[model samples]
Target: MKKIYIEIKWAFIYSITLLAWMLLENTLGWHQERIADQWWLTLLFIPFAVFIYLLAVREKRRRVYDRKMTWPQAFLSGAILSVFIALLTPISSYIINNYITPELFFNAMDYSTKNVGMTQSDANEYVLLTTYLWQSPIGALAFGLATAAIVALFVRKK
Candidate 1:
């Protein structure tokens, strides 16, 4: 169960870091002023991805697997982290969207309409769909698991 604990700890760290990063970005108006225009912000995922991989693999290699880890073990650790992230995302999403910077939601809608060529109605629907569906728990789970599977491939020690 130590491995499970490690995965959970890392997951919590990663999730919190993600929330902080998002909050900082939004607070700085990056999401509002620059995100749509600057495609490079999307590359931020690469660092987070590498961080997740390193945390999972390094912990496995150091503590649980003891210098060597199998692919299945690496995958399992990543999956456990994913599940935790999936579980926590909803609460984080709610807090961030509701309390931290609710304006981003509306800003997103406007950006969608103006830049993405979406009509007002379509933008509204898109926001509703993304908020209720794509950013929801199920969507988090799906994305988390997919990320875990891919990260595990590189994280596996042997």
Candidate 2:
């Protein structure tokens, strides 16, 4: 439990750093400008990505006896992170749906209805699918694993 807390703390740190980076870069300059609702959504990914990396390490350490954890540890850490992120995915989506961009639903529906090659019915179906994708916890976990694996392969110490 203590270790999970520590890892979550690190994850928050990682998430905040990501937010700071984006703020610095102006990529997520929406909140400051008051024209954005998905800033929270963007920010949510930061800790999620970090959590995946850290948890993957936890996974690795759990299986290994060596004092130093290895690549497999990193890989599994990502998987663990992914599951956690998935579990918490609702918090962000709920915010987005209820507050951040309530209009997003209609707006996206409108755009897709007009812009895509698909029929309105098909477009609506796709939109719903995309919404569900955003809602899915498993997707988050899988992405976490992928991102963690990439980062681990390059970032882990030799």
Candidate 3:
């Protein structure tokens, strides 16, 4: 536990960052008026996510390995961080869906049914909170591991 404290800390930071991003999107009308554009607009968060992974792995390398961490060591640290992020994703998503942008699912369903030609039932099933609660953690783990793999390469030191 103590050995991976940095990963835990960074996981919290990433979760907070995710909340902040969702709030920003909601403030910019992405969750309502600009709901159609939200799908593509959310891609903008990729860089920020990668940056956080880079920072986490780099910090682990410096603090735990004394600046001499190997690629595998950095990757392992990042993988641990990714697990932490996955564990926290459901809670973060609940906050976003319920508190930060309560209208998001409704807005998405409306847009999908009207513009995307999705059936009402399909929209309801796909856009609901339960789906997101499960999907968010899976997405976090997949993306987190991928980001960790890449970030590890760059952060690894001799």
Candidate 4:
């Protein structure tokens, strides 16, 4: 528990950053009038995600491992951080979908059915809050682990 203090702290930071990004997207009209551009614009979050992972692993290496961390140590620390992020993703998603951008699903469904050729049923199934409730945590884990792996390689000292 003591050793993972850094990971826990970084996990909160990552979750806050994710929420901030969603707020930015909503403010930019991506959740409504600019829904068409939302998909690509959202992908821009990759850099922020990677940077957060890098910072997490680097902090763990510097603080927990005393600057002598190996690849495995960094990777484990990041994996733990990823787990924390995964655990928090549902709450973040709930807040974002329910509060920050309540109309996002409807807008996405509209775009999907009109421009992307998705049937209404398909769009409904794909774009709802329940769907995001499940997808968000899975996506967070998958992306977080992948980011952790790559970031571990770079942050590892020896």
Candidate 5:
């Protein structure tokens, strides 16, 4: 419980930072909620990245790689961390979509459609794909591995 509390606190801190960044960078500055909408996409990385970062280090230093946790263990915990993002992302999305300024979504969608050199259908498809793709297991693996590797380099077991 102590270990988990430590790990999650860092991840949540980074996640909140990212969220604040999204609010400031996308909607407030450029008035680009569509791009900002995608910012929530990072919610996927926050928990997985931080936890795997710490866990991989601990696992390696303790010489427990031989007893490595199955991917299921890493992934299940990652999913739990992301749940925070999932809950907050949609509510944030709603506030941006409905309250802050409705035109931002339309503007972003329009900009994406025109600049991508794709038809409306394709652009819409891209948006949908990009939105959910970050949360997939593949994304988790990619981020988790990269983060874990870096943290592992510095890990020292107790």
Candidate 6:
């Protein structure tokens, strides 16, 4: 359990790091100016997810499995870490959307209107739907589990 706690701690720290990076980008207006319509920014989620799973599994292997962890153990550790991440997502999303980048929604709506050829009502609906999906804990759970399942395969030692 100590190993799991440590992994969860790291996961929390990583989440904060990601939130800070996002806030910095938004504060600089990068999302609005440069990447508004680009999907590249979505790539950022991969590394964070990979690191969370990899580090968790590695730590578990090192401390608990004598550096020879089985797939089940690796998967379990990664899944547990993902659960922590999912639990933390709502709070982080709230802080980021409400406090850090309240203008993000407007920017997104504008982008949708200009780039996606969306009507005002359609853009508004798009933002609201996507935001709700992104912030939804159910989505987080599904994504976390899938990420854990995939990343565990690579991180497992034995």
How good is model 2 by TM-score?
0.61
**Which ten residues in a row are the worst by lDDT in model 4?**
57-66
Model 4: per-residue Cα lDDT at residue 23: 98
lDDT preference between candidates 1 and 5, better one:
1
Q: Better model by TM-score, 4 or 5?
A: 4
**lDDT at position 88, candidate 5:** 47
lDDT of 5: 0.50
Error of 5 at 158 (Å): 8.7
lDDT of each: 0.71, 0.55, 0.91, 0.90, 0.50, 0.74
Clashing pairs in 2: 55-77, 56-76, 56-77, 56-78, 57-77, 60-73, 82-141
- Candidate 3 global lDDT: 0.91
**Top candidate by TM-score:** 3
What is the TM-score of each predicted model, taking all chains together? 0.81, 0.61, 0.97, 0.96, 0.50, 0.82
What TM-score number comes out for model 4? 0.96
How much is the lDDT of residue 30 in candidate 3?
Answer: 92
Better of 2 and 3 by TM-score: 3
Candidate 6 per-residue lDDT, tens place, 1-158, comes to 67677668867876787688777677666666865633576566668667766776777788878989777877787777777877787887788778887777788888889887999998897788456646556766777778778877887775
**Residue 117, candidate 5: alpha-carbon lDDT:** 71
lDDT of 4 by residue, 56-78 (tens): 88877777778888888988988
Regions of model 5 farther than 4 Å from truth: 31-105, 129-141
Full candidate order by lDDT, most accurate first:
3, 4, 6, 1, 2, 5
Tell me the tens digit of each residue's lDDT in model 2 across 1-158.
75455345544444445445545434444433433344365655665556546554654455442445556756655555556666666664565456544555555556556654567777677667356656556666677767778756744444
How far out, in Å, is residue 60 in model 3? Answer: 0.6
